[model samples]
Target: MRLPFPSLSTLPPTLAKPPRYFPTLISHTSTTTTPYYRPLSRSLSHPSQPHHPQANHSTTPPPPSSKMSSPAPAQYVTVTPTPSGYALLTIHRNPVNSMNTLLWSQLQAALDRCEQDPNIRGLILTSGLSRPVFTAGNDLTEIFAPMTSREQYARFWTVSNQFLARLYRSPLITAAAIHGACPAGGTAMSMACDHRSISLHPASSMGLNEVAIGIPVPAKWAQLMATLTGQGEANRLCGFGKMVDAAEAKRIGLVDSLVDGEGKEVVADAVRWMEKTLRLPDVGRVITKAHFRDRLSREWEDEEWLRSEAEGAWEMLASDEVVTVLGGVMQRMSGKAKI
Candidate 1:
């Protein structure tokens, strides 16, 4: 079944006229300040506009600048509470929904709102684009050295992973509907969810493709993938940085349900699947999820360990070799330099 994208006119007033920057919200009770809001765009990317990357890591500050200029409130994400007792929290950072620091915070804001609300029984996470790209994953700026400071990279690492940890442990039912390419950070987000449904659309594929970009998949992210797809399979997939197509993803148990449609249909099916989970006793389901997933969240909360990882990520980004590779990839993605 095809579910039409929600137009601003038909959406609730809150969404139609979203507050400037999505308000600061707490993830696991810790507040984050991420100022951004971009009006939605439909195309993958146009040269006239800024390019979004499918890069890894997050944040521009490995060493945050005190004089950091705040971006205008960008609407990279949206939330629509459905009558079906679930809310659709979309990642709409157009041009492939790159997981930048701003997009991450906006998403966390939306997720926190849902988790705080009693009326919402579940959250369905999906991309909001006419095309099939679920999310191109990490925004390149977060990973690019010349463009990002050590402080900024540090923040990106923290916010991005923290959001993933929170999603993994969220009490509300969390589901991912992947209608297209999902790699690295994208896989991290979906794998953290309680369940994932992917479109069998020809263009669709999902995996942890970090190595291909000259990066190691974060240990926690690899562990989460391992949890879902088994240690052995995850080892193969992650080690090779394979972005598996729908059939392989299903076969490997990387994603739970395989919807035979694109865009709205894929997400619609995920909603249906989540509804069944919501029908069960909430307390029981929430507890069961925690029993299996809480350990990861606790580990993310380890300041010393997280800082060490961030430092490592920072060191890598600062390396000349990785910088050149990322720049080349960015040039190709932005249509500036062809492969």
Candidate 2:
């Protein structure tokens, strides 16, 4: 059944309050800083897919085989069909689910498989296990790899942008269940989804802190952040590169709500929410979602903008300053450098 667009009168009291802006928590010389909270418009199941809820999933682990994308290693991603006709894509990379070219390809493959399956009504995107850190963002080692040419850097940015476009334009309802630290690219992935929820914990922080690490948030990404938080706020968070806790994230509208539990509980909560959203007629939900989001998707069609974004992304990766900062971070994470 189709429902009318929600109005102010229909919103809950907690949401009706005026948006409260928070001061900049992180400072970046080139970055800029807002307080406007907009009601985030936010969506499940499939059968016949492997791991279908009805399937007597093998007690024995399955062999590694490419099931999703053409040639990408699919080991990093898993797709299971829910009884409700939704697909659950679990991001599982050891240590941390850092985004690499392979992970990106695998993720896109999982998305492609679920989107192509008519039985799948929606998608729940989340990490594999309950970890303190959902994903530390991109694999900085790969991102800061010794680049011989701009084309190499461009390829990396292109892969990232392409996958992001898929997430942004997916016809199926998508939700992100974030439980731990979601920064930079992780933040972008969640924002691309139709709805997002984060676990309530002091360690749980989320934001597009790309600039803090020397990467420029692309135009489309920038617009997505702006859509949730005002333009100035987007710049402040992304440019200054700061991570905000779950409470602040919810208050700023970065997340729709703060989940009470951690790990699988958080995933279940998000899945339940998506399942509820799926009760609405798919036709209306899909159309209305597109109506609100297609404007930003169309921005990718601009050839000039794409070229500029690619060039700028490459420039950031190639900059001596950016490389040094990235290298430093990696060293710290690896315990090669001390505070």
TM-score of each: 0.78, 0.74
Query: For residue 248, what is the lDDT in candidate 1?
Result: 95
Candidate 2 residue 17 Cα shift, in angstroms, is 40
Each prediction's whole-model lDDT (CA): 0.75, 0.68
Predicted candidate 1 versus true structure: per-residue lDDT over 63-137, tens digit per residue: 545654455567777788877778888778667788888788877767766655556778898888877888888
lDDT for residue 312 in candidate 1, whole number 0-100:
89
Q: Which sections of candidate 2 miss by over 4 Å?
A: 1-74, 145-149, 301-307, 335-339
Residues 9-31, candidate 2: write the lDDT tens digits. Answer: 44322112212211121111223
Ten contiguous residues with the weakest lDDT in model 2? 38-47
Candidate 1 scores a C-alpha RMSD against the true structure in Å of 12.6
What's the C-alpha lDDT at position 298 in model 2? 49
